[model samples]
Target: MSVQIQAEEQRYSRQQIRDLATELLINVGVREQFPTPLEEIIHYLGYTIEEFEPDDDTDRVSGAVNHRQQIIYINHQDAPRRQMFTLAHEIGHVFLHREQEANHIDYRDGAMTPREQEANHFAAELLMPENHFRHTWMTWEGEPELVAATYGVSAEAVRVRADILKLT
Candidate 1:
């Protein structure tokens, strides 16, 4: 019921992971750098999304994905934007950590490894792509919150993306 990195068998650079995620979006016909329907992309990749409740003590586990079954579950209590991030993060694991996922490793250790960090980058990129984010920023005239609303992502995600894209 959990998808995890197995013993860190494969180490992917954050950039590599981000490239893969962008490639996936392109493969799914995302030709524009705009707010993509993260749910539709997940479904297109054969993933089904559901909402669940997590205990207050479990902040590390916001969401979980089972790629073999093509299912993703997000915490119901999380902010909508947080759930979006979790979904995109899980999508990162689907491609970046295929082997460990194929072996059915449950990533419940709550440790932040290169893989997890890469996944976070992937999530940020997927939710807010570089070029599209830049354009959106220009449209909003430097208001991150406005960009966040249009993209259905968090304001923090927008700012982080802005920093990554050197727009800040």
Candidate 2:
């Protein structure tokens, strides 16, 4: 799916996005920095990450009061990194786009909604900041995999960030 990043404002820095997500957690009565695994973050907030063993068409979903307590539903068959991205994507929804009333993002093979697009942008920027990402990419031979591996994300994500930086 092609995400339209034109509408996204550059006003907020990546640190600001991270702060906002952290602030949101605090406002919801959760103390302490939400952990790194992302799944642990959900659990720390009193949610559960469950596996939908029989479902094939779904990637992940969040369920809880106001999704405050989130449940990350994923297919067990997905790759480790793909599942991590799924969790990060849902975290994008929960922290960034939930105010727009989005939930249960099914993996689509086509176009993305504007909100989804924005969330994807937010996710990329949050995961891989332009300054550090560009520096890392520049050190490489313009190979997306090298940078993606460094960021622990997909090559496409690296490409998008590189595009934003005019590095690719």
* Each model's backbone clash number: 1, 0
Can you write out model 1's per-residue Cα lDDT over 1-57, one digit (the tens) per residue? 232433564677667766887888888887464566787788777778877667666
In candidate 1, stretches whose alpha carbon ends up further than 4 angstroms from where it belongs are: 1-9, 56-60, 102-110
Clashes of 2: 0
**How well is each residue in 1-168 modelled by candidate 2, as lDDT tens digits?**
123343233234556665665554455554332222565556654656766663444433322123644565665667665665666666666666554452454454535865466556555654665556677788887799887787677787677778877886
The Cα local distance difference test for each model comes to 0.75, 0.58
Best of the candidates, lDDT = 1
Candidate RMSDs in Å, in order, are: 4.5, 7.2
**True lDDT of residue 21, candidate 1:** 76
